[model samples]
Target: MNATDRTPADLLGSALARDPAHPLVTFYDDATGERVELSVATFANWVAKTANLLQDDLGAEPGDRLALLLPAHWQTAVWLLACSATGVVADVGGDAARADLVVAGPDALDAARPCGGERVALALRPLGGRFPQPPEGFLDYAVEVPGQGDRFAPYAPVDPDAAALAVPAGSAGGPEELSGARVVERARADAAARGLAPGARVLSTLGYGDWAGLSAGLYAPLAAGASVVLCRNSAALAPEELARRVASEQVTHTAA
Candidate 1:
């Protein structure tokens, strides 16, 4: 475990410095036959750009809530880190009416409109393609992110004790909120529980609607300094096809 890493952003920074060329995340969509891999450096770049978009353009400050209306896609993972870097609390599947900002995919646009704050939409297309027809009353993320700076420096240091992530109270007792430090701690715990080590590759087929899925699909591998094969729509894949992916991606561990 990394004693110095107190937050998700810290873990990402450590990973970026340890090995920038190593693959950090490999994403797939079984139905679309799409696969994309991102190195640590590349993923960091995306995080930086998205952070800038949140901070500079949207004027989002620390403690502000962002209702994230997306699924378990690679871009959603990027948004998670970006929120941590900026000290913005990401409310996964949260109530848009209570948010200061909103980011949604094409399918979630209808659910995002209640937020009066600045709204952003992601196409979630292959290779990060822009929406062919822009949605009204929203900024297109793919079109805006390229113009952002490659490096990010938050105006203020993030507070580890402050809330970072809030999951909707689905079938649970109440909403679950975690501080930055707790997020890192849980990720590390999950990573160790799954027997991940540095450079280990993990395959996960979990959605991002709750803490369990987030831990397995993204944060755990990242905290372990390992990599992930993040699969979207895994239910569509045949059993043989799933086996093929495990062999092809060289997955050493699995969390599902």
Candidate 2:
């Protein structure tokens, strides 16, 4: 692959080189009154552990589908990059039955029950809390990820032309497939179109099921060397609270 044929993992590596200490993902959960910030290095560490779990523990490989039934939390962002690092195709909001693995948020447990492959669940609580009792038929993400090695080394090279993402059904009139190279290209272009300045801090309240949402939440910010303040349940916040968050976080851009 050419140097220009970039993948999501490549973008993260560049961001770490540019400034590892800079905040890469600032997350807010309005319903729970939770706020968390992760620097590039910290986020990369999480990605590494998650990637190792996928490859070493779950035996996931390139072309294998991982259904991601998650919300727009910091952990979800971590999983997205983890999938990229391990060359697993992320099927956002896809049917669990058709996937090689199913990762579900707490609210999606019932929906994920029928998946035939490995199953993982995230509590999405503060500080990566695990479920009080592990969900039946599912491994808790917070419990499992921390125990994995912090450094990731894929068993094989990932193809830049291989499928990387599958958008949710009805998005872009139907599901859309994006290759690793195309994912990066679209991210950079979207960042440019949004006028994202280098190292800018952007706040977004978009889900990860569609192209625009995924770009704004993760890829576009990384592509522009910017950071993301991902807000979940933004609808539950008042206008004053939203404004206050933006001001407090020093956010330079907004996406909804």
Candidate 3:
């Protein structure tokens, strides 16, 4: 892969071709006692299905905004890449009302109701199960995604210069947009600044709300050809427990 290739989809493709069976994303939910590990191939599979759902099922075209009302989990990582692959702009934590599609978790149901476009809900259960009783206005992601094609092809090729992310300002500013190339550029720089060596396994307990967090938690690792061990409900863990996880999971770098 060329060093200048900056699209998230291109980063993933490089990773898959370099090491298909290597761990890509390892997720842990301390509150739920859930742990899932996805290799590069497995991660790519999930991204493909979700991308197909976005492109084909939801009619998401290039530049379409999809509000990702989700937390830091394995599937959320999948959705980010899926959006890149399908040329959709992932608006993480953005308002659903302004989006073309909304993919929400249980906590965001009420907030996502006003979204007039397509809505998909993730139960976030162990093994990615569907809700016992489906939410009234949202399609269950687990139920719908499995039926999508395993392979994904965007309606049109993604332009590296096109907007790929919409990040709301944390302080006193308007929302910031990042092009596909910029996303990759930022990730690589952030990874190097954080001293993430090549193929490092990084553990992070951060939300994907801003550029820094998103870069550290997902894109940076991909840019470095590293893997991520994403931990949610991190408040439930003691300092010693976190250290134990770092050792057990073979985490070489950490972004707290």
lDDT against the true structure, each candidate? 0.93, 0.90, 0.90
What is the descending TM-score order? 1, 3, 2
Kindly indicate the candidate among 2 and 3 with the higher TM-score. Answer: 3
Q: Give lDDT: candidate 1, residue 199.
A: 86
Residue 44 accuracy (lDDT) in model 3: 98
| lDDT comparing candidate 3 with the true structure | 0.90
List, residue by residue over 60-142, the lDDT tens digit for candidate 3: 89999999999988999999999999889999898889988999999999989889999999999999999999999999999
- Per-residue alpha-carbon lDDT of candidate 1 for residues 1-256, written as tens digits (9 for 90 to 100): 3689988999999999889999999999876888999999999999999999999999999999999999999999999999999999999998888999999999999999999999999999999999998899999999999999999999999999999999866775656899999999989988888889998999999899998889888899999989999999889778898888899999998767
Higher-scoring candidate on TM-score, 1 or 2: 1
Q: What ranges in model 3 sit over 4 Å off?
A: none
TM-score of each model, paired residue for residue = 0.98, 0.96, 0.97
